[model samples]
Target: MAKLYFRYGLGKSAQLCQVAYNYFEQRNMEIAVINAKDNETIRSRIVVDGKNVLVREPNFDLKPGVSLYEKIYLRDSDVGLKCILVDNAEYLKEEQAEDLFYISKMLDIPVIAYGNRLIDEKKTSLGVCRLMALADDIEKIDMSMPSKRATLDFNYGAMNCSKTAQLLTKDQSLIDEGFKTCIIKPKLDRDELYIASRIGLRKKADIILDLDDNIYGQAEYLYRDRINHILVDEAQFLTPRQIEQLRRIVNDYNMPISCYGLKSDFLSNLFPGSQRLLEISDNIYKMNTVCSCGCGANFNVRKDRFDNYVTEGEQVCIDQGDNYDSECALCFMEHVMKIDTASRKRVRKK
Candidate 1:
């Protein structure tokens, strides 16, 4: 019995969504799609790397999974729908959401709603709020919505967070369970650090992602053929909106996604992406790394060519001109920011 999922899109997660839809379609599983999104989002699937995956379109037939109004005229035995998918669910009315529940209970199929969100955040509206409360399972990820569905797994630490290596160790387990997995490789991650080939994830990622451009159509096209779970490297670069979108993707598709990256940037600022993951993820993990001080480390600092801490610079510098290293938050502040947080804490204690 599939549970209702309230999936949201963060950043440019629209494309990754199609991949999951395609996966379900390939398995011959029935699905429903409803939408209140005003902008006529391109729901068509575009082939990527030569695959015929399904995209944003709902594949449900009226015979089994009809619209709310459509079900009114028919008897329960006449409907054969397996799943109900609604887009732009924010536009629904509280009564409409209630109708869905009645329909779902009668049909014994899952009802999924899609909306735009910034990770764990939601817009307060009578309709959406009512729907959230009525959902059997609120999954914001590949697991459950409301950070309760599946689990939002996280792995964070300093530079070269060994999380990638650890995630690889879990690959065989997924394979053993008859699950197919793919990694989200951002195009901007062209640096040596983001190279899949260098990261032991050679050939693991079946798709390459360009956050600048929407890839939802292509993902749907490809995943319609195969894919089960998702993995992402350099998730710190992801925007809060994108993280929400990924969370929704996992929920709608029923796949687990693992994100690995630094918790904070060199200046100790929370990367927008990491902040959202921390706020909404179900399972959080910290990858281990040593700082320059040799004590247990988690913070990061940018360095100049002369091995000096670079204080003034852009937030994201992919160019080889800048370098980064891991350090403790205390060292990052005292040695880099020169704030001496230890002293501040000591004085505040008094």
Candidate 2:
């Protein structure tokens, strides 16, 4: 039997698994990628390494201790799958992980599981740590590195991003134009200006201040019938789901929503919230800035107190001494990543 492996990562675990699946398939290995979610609403196809990777909804009964991939393998006279993958395995209960382990032993096929360290607290045994305890081998992946950074900031202006100051100015202008604008910021963003929000991250933002952070709980502070526009600051700290919720509010309330945030993190990875904004925002605008290399830049980098580049750590450290700046993709790849300039692909302006 192929060994069972648990793959855990920060921020990019899902993408990591997808990349692995693609690699295996390219090598002429048969693989069954299963979606563990009971609803599995996300079936969108993704283009990876220039090839199509479809998100397949699992056809098996996905409940704990009930996985039976062997039957499906036998019934289909197709390429024999050497391995099976459980994407979003954190959603599975402990018993479900057990089931997969048992199935792997019985079928003599590897079962690879992927999940992030973050977990929904409401769950019973779906915690990622629990599943890790049951795996034959464990692999943890994180692109973040410790800072040799002089300053750690999410300065988009340096990266050709629309400036936060510009966003605020626009909001003030709209407010002056007789628009009822509500401005809010995520607690994660450490701007000189601050706003209070819920203890945890929220998807929706149309509410007033309250001890509780939900719309209904904060109803005393908001006039649902009176809001004319919504402006969000430090929006990069929000969850992707929250970005969609803001969109729904914009339509349902018949108001416009403007969000300003870093499109990607210091590691040049997309923030979940910013990515959602890119996907569904009505209008996307860039406040461009110039890089030190004299090219227009749009990527952020992290440096340590000693001014050395730091490449290890989590994607976010809300208040660290590290420094951040923007650079062109080419320069960042060359200077920070040490990629050969000749091998670097020219990054075109958006």
Best by lDDT: 1
TM-score of 2: 0.47
Q: Please give, for residues 1-350, the per-residue lDDT of candidate 2 as tens digits.
A: 34567765553334535554575656766666666667363243456887645454453446454434444345223655667777677677665665555444444467777664344522323434444433445555544674332211122233334455665666668879987767666655543344432342223333322212333222224446475656776677777666656666655544566777777677656676665564455444555776897866656788888898877667787546788888865566566656555531121111
**Model 2 misplaced stretches (Cα beyond 4 Å):** 1-162, 191-225, 342-350
lDDT of 2 at 328: 69
Model 1 lDDT, full chain set? 0.59
- Note the Cα lDDT for every prediction shown: 0.59, 0.55
**Alpha carbon deviation, residue 38, candidate 2 (Å):** 29
| Reference-based TM-score of each model | 0.53, 0.47
